[model samples]
Target: MRDALVKYGFIAVTVVLFVFFAATEPAFAQSSTMFSMLKFASVTAILGLGVTFTMVVGGLDLSIGATAGLAVQLAAMTMVFYNLTGPTAVAAVLLGGVLVGLANAVLIVVFKIPDLLATLGMMFVIQGAKLIPVSGQSVSSGMVLRDGSVAPGRFTPDFLLIDRGFVGPVPLPVVIMLVLVVVSWFVLSRTSAGRILYAIGANPEAARLAGVRVGLYRGLAYVISGLFASVGGLILVSRIGQGDVNAGASSLLEAVAVALVGTSVLGLARPNAWGTLLGALLVAIVLTGLTMKGFQYYHQDTAKGFVLIVALLFSFTLSRRKVRYTPAT
Candidate 1:
């Protein structure tokens, strides 16, 4: 009984916070605000879900943030500098992300580097490499008027539409996020690779003894993480309509927080898609509530930090209890 209560405490806290904010802020429950929150959560959820893959394998990829930024830069450069079409630009962006993941995998698995150090070094490399092509300048498309005259300035209908356009009542980026989330969930829960990943995370030696190719699965996890980060980068580009050097700087931190939080929900100590989804929603709600309450941006960061610390404490306490209550052989 005590174990169950402790394990579920975070969910209870999340609900309480939601109710409290909804009561205090008149606009908290408003339809428009709700939609806006969902939009924000959708993006975070996509990125968070990607990170979950790495966490499930008991590995971490600090390069995901930089990978996302690189993807954005690649996409924008393809369109603006290389004069590539949208589809081609997207393909190149995703490919770049996967290649970055491959590099991380090589360093960690083949070269026997620690996951954290390998990914951290790769993060810096990705950051520097992304800046070289654009010379650290934001890339934007040029305008083409109806008369086929190209405007000298760097703003285009295509670029702006990427950020602001929608399909019917749904935002395109949000729809894309949903599709990715569903795909990620399916891959993680219904596939043999997913089971191998969990087994490795739970016990690498045991998984190896069970005939699972630990190195290959670990490498694949990082690749999946990178690919998902690319998807997030594309959505972010669609949201902002341009490539910013600092585009995904906070993504890694947020993704980590979401993955950790997911571990506590439903007693799922390993990464689960639904848990990540809920974790992302929790973050979005907290940020949205703070914004609605007129809190400063810095205060929002502080609040997030506090929330993360509390979640960690709660999860650890519950985990200890579970370990203690397990029957001894």
Candidate 2:
């Protein structure tokens, strides 16, 4: 009974919270409002998946947000500045993602720098470097460039459809998010590669002794993290249709928070894609509810922080209890 509660407590809390919000804010219960909320949450969920992969391998990926920012910026620059085709722009940005992943892998696995510090430094640097291409301006249609010339190209319709187009009433990004979750879950839960990665996270020395290539797997995890972050960025830019400088910065906290929150989900005591999605949904619901209650943007972080703390405590306490009550081998 206790084990079940630890595993399923979030479901109950999520229901209770939904009920409370629905009761307090009628607007939140509307179908359109729900769609909007889900759409907003999808980006965070996507990024959280990437973060979860890194966390599953016992590493942090602080640069995912910046990586995403760079992806969108480069894509926008290709389309609007260089007058490239949509596919070409997308290809360029995806390549950028791979490169960013390689950089993170080199720093962490090759140079042996701490994950937190390496990604953190990359975050600041990439976030700043992104400005150089746009001449420190946001990329929007008809926006004057640094040279006082108007941007000739706009977001192509095909690129815009990546996020905005629907397939049988489902938002594209939501569908993509679901697909990624399935893929991530499949890879992590089913594949030998995924098992080894998890093993390394749990016990690196043991994994190494068992012939696992720890360095290679560690680097691979970071590469995936970087790639997914870029995918998230691509989705966000496709939806918004502009390269807003601070958009990526805002996502960093939400992505990490939701990813960490996933760790305690279902008493799994590890990072998982479903938990990350659930965490993102929980945050989205709370924020939507708060917004209906007239919560200001500046103060919304407090509520988010509180939710994160409660989740951490819940997971930590249950984890300890699980160990205490476990039977000896």
Candidate 3:
């Protein structure tokens, strides 16, 4: 029973909440509502996946939110300031993500800094540096520049389609999120490289002794994380059609929470894309249900905290009990 609880508890809780919401709010079961929930979870899921990569390599990226915010700013600037095309904006944002990831890799892998401290410092740098170009202003269509001239470009319709467009009634973001989940799941759960990452996480010295390039894989993890963050930020700007300075304000908290909750999913106790998706869905469901019940914005955080605590309990408490009592095979 304890083992089952450890493995299925989070999933069970998610289903219960979903059912409760559906029963109490008839609209919650509607296709539109479900899609909307998925859409909202998309960015959280992507960011969580990026964080998962870092976790797999025994590191945590505190700078993902800031990196994503930088993407948002870059994308917005490309279109709204430089009057560039949608494709160009995307290229620029993705490039920015790679650079940030490389910087983080250098800090942690080359400089021998602790992962948390390195990412934390990077987070601060990105948050401040992203503002310098716009002189600390959000990017939007026709915004006035520092030179006292009006910026002329608008978010191209093609760019907005990334957020608003749907494929056979499903939101594009949801589809994108699902695609990322599938690909990441395959990479982490099926491949030798994935196994190497887990090995590194479990024991870097042991992995190094086995002839694995520990630094290389660790650097790769951060790069993957950065790419994921960039995509998340790109989706955000596309959805809002502007670059809000605070675009990623809550992203760090939400991303980290989902990634942590994901560790408890299926009793994996490790970062996995499928678990991250479930975690994101759980958060989205809670937030959407609370909103439908007329709860204020701040209350959503409390609900997320409650869910996370329960997940941790199910993951750690029961697993310990199971290990303590089980007989040797």
Candidate 4:
């Protein structure tokens, strides 16, 4: 009974919550509302995937949100300031993500800094550095530049399609999120490299002794994380059609919370892509339901925190009992 509860309880609770919201709020039952919730979850889930990759390597990345914010700024600058095309903006942000990830690898793997501290420092650096080009102003169409000239470009229609266009009946962002989650799940759960990564996470020294390139794989994890963050940022830029200086400010907390909550999902007790998606869904439901129920914006955070705590408690406290078995004599 305990094991069954540990495995299925979270899913059951989520379903119950969904049903409750649908029953009470007439608007929540609408198809548009459902898609809107999924679209919101898509970005959060992508950011969570970034954190998940690092977590699998037994490391934490505090810089994911800042890296994403930098992507947002870079994409906007590419299109709105440099008068470049959407593809150029996409390429710019992806390159920026890789560079940030590489720098993190250098700091942590080569320079021997603690992962948390290194990423935390990087977060601050990125947050500050992204503001330098525009003199701390948000980037948008027709914004005045430093030399008293208005920016000549705006977000191209092609770029806006990334977030706005629908494939059949599904939103593009949601489809992207689903594809990423599926790919990530396959890579982490079905491949030899994935096994090696888990082995390293379990015991780095042991994995090193077993002929695994511990440092290399760990570095790769950070790079993947950075790439995911950049993608999330690009999606955000497409959605908003401009770069807000405050973009990605809330991403860190939301992503971290999603990742943490994912660990215990389905009793897996590990960071996983499916679990991350589920966690994102749970959070989206809570926040959207509260909004429809007339709850204040500030109270939404508290509700999210509460759900995370409960999920974790079930994962850690209730699922840790030992099962004793006698070996054949």
Candidate 5:
């Protein structure tokens, strides 16, 4: 019973939170509120999914938030400055993200920089670089450019449809996030590629000796992470109809928090798309419910931090107990 509780505790907590919020705030039970939670959770889930790819390979993607920010600026700038259409803008930004991933790969794989340090350094570089293109200004329609003239282009309605338009009463972001989660889960759990990644994560040296291309697999993890982050950025900009330079910091912190908490989800004890999505939903529910209750935004991070710590402790304790209980060989 204790083991079961430890293993499934996060799910129980999420259910309790939902029930408590519904009971305390009658409106929280409404379909509108549920949809709102799903919409917001979609972005965090996307980011967490990106981070999960890296984590599965015993790596980290600290630059996800900055990568998202860079993507937003690039996507927005392409449409507004280059007179590019929706698809062109998206393609440009996604390629930019892929480049960022390649850069991280070169730094970590080639130079042998530690994962955390490599990504952390990249986070700062990308964050600063994003601001330079816009002259430290936010990207909005008809905004004044560095040359002192108002920009003419606007975010096309077609592009906006990616996040705003609904398909059969479902939010677009929610739909996209869900579909990507299922696809990613299948790739990670049901394919030979997944087996190789797990083997590399388990022991990179052994995997390489066993004929696995460690550098290629490891670098691809960052590439996947970058692409996912770019998608999140696209959704973010589309939802707001503008690109805000300062958007990346909060996203980075929250997404990382959610991903770390996912490590212990359902006793997986490792990164998984399903776990990341659930963790994101939990974070979103807590924040949304609290905000509806009139809680200040500043205090919400504290609650989120507490929840993460509890999840970590829950997983750590169980792993230790299991190790201690194993009989002598």
Candidate 6:
């Protein structure tokens, strides 16, 4: 009972804070504000889910933020330069993300490059590559077709709803986020591949002895991470109606923070979908609360650092208790 409480303490704290804020602030509990929060959560949750994959394989993909940014650039450029439809542009961007993921996998698994160094290098590569098409200019939404003519912006009301439009009472982005959460949960918890990943993270040598293909699984993990980033990038473009070169920079740190928070929740001890969801929600709630209070924006960064520190402390404390209670060898 005490152990369970320790594991879920953060959730309780978040709930309490949310209720308190909703009661105290007039605008905080508005339906529009709630929808906005969910929209923000969707972007961060997608990024966190991707980070979870790399962490499960005992690696980190620092390039996810950059990859997502590059994906947005690719999607926009496709529509602008190649005259591709939205669906086609999205498909091509996702495939590009997968190829980048595969490249990262090769660098780490085949070339013996460290995951951190390899991903960091890939981060720069993607960042620089994203600039090649626009030559450092933000690709205007009003782009010309390949036949040497300006293409007027297509303003389909139904298409706009995918990001900004809502279904009855729920926002479309929120629904998409929920669907992704379920799919990611199934992939990580119910699949044989998922178990293999946990095994690798816990002990790669032991997993190899058990006949698991460590290298292949590690590579696949990166690819999954990149794919998730692509989804996030698409949703982001939809929400803003345009993509920014700097959109992905903040996501890298936010994703890592959310993943680490998941590690501390419910004694999950491994990367988990529900835990990641809760973690992202917690961060969103904190930022919302702080912003509502008119706190300086810079203090939000301090708050994030504090949250991470506390979460790590809680994780270490719980881990020590488990070790101490285990039967003697």
lDDT, candidate 6, equals 0.79
- Model 5: what TM-score? 0.95
The lDDT ranking, best first, is 3, 4, 2, 5, 6, 1
Model 3, 256-287: lDDT tens digits are 88888888888887788898899999999999
- What's each prediction's TM-score? 0.89, 0.94, 0.96, 0.96, 0.95, 0.91
**lDDT per model, in order?**
0.78, 0.85, 0.90, 0.89, 0.84, 0.79
Q: Between which residue pairs do clashes occur in model 1?
A: none
Ranking by TM-score: 3, 4, 5, 2, 6, 1
Q: How close is candidate 4 to the true structure, as a TM-score?
A: 0.96
lDDT score at residue 75, model 2, on the 0-100 scale: 84
Model 1, span 1-329: residue lDDT tens: 75676568778878988898999998998877876787787767877887888887888888988898998888777776667677777788889989988998899889988788899999999989888866677776674433565533332456445446677777666676677778877887898877888777777888999888999998998898889889888878867877787899988898888877777776656677877777887888899998888888888778878777766666676566331111101
Weakest ten-residue segment in model 3 by summed lDDT = 320-329
Q: How many backbone clashes does candidate 5 have?
A: 0
Instruction: Encode model 5's per-residue lDDT on 1-329: one tens digit a residue.
Output: 76787788888998999999999999999998898899989988999888888877888889999999888898889888766799998998889889999998888888888888999999999999888889888888898888998887889999999889898889999999999899889988899887787777777888899999888888898899899999999999898788788876788877877777877777767778888888899988899889999999998889899888877776677644421111101
**Full-model lDDT, candidate 1:** 0.78
lDDT of 5 at 292: 91
Residue ranges of candidate 4 with Cα displaced over 4 Å:
321-329
**Per-residue alpha-carbon lDDT of candidate 2 for residues 1-329, written as tens digits (9 for 90 to 100):** 77777788876777889999999888889988888888889989999998888887788888998999998898889888888888998898888988988898899888988888888899988989999878788898888887888989889999999898887888888888899999999999999999998888887788999999999998998889888888898898998899888768878888989988887778887888888999999999998888889889887899899989877776777656431111101
> Model 6 over residues 1-329: C-alpha lDDT tens digits?
65776677767777887898898887888988888888888888888888888888888889999988987777767765555677777788799889889999999999989888999999999999898767676555575544557755442344345678777788888888788888878987899998888778777888999999999999998999999888888887666665577768788999888888887777666678887788888787788888999999999899888877766666666554421111101
TM-score of 1: 0.89
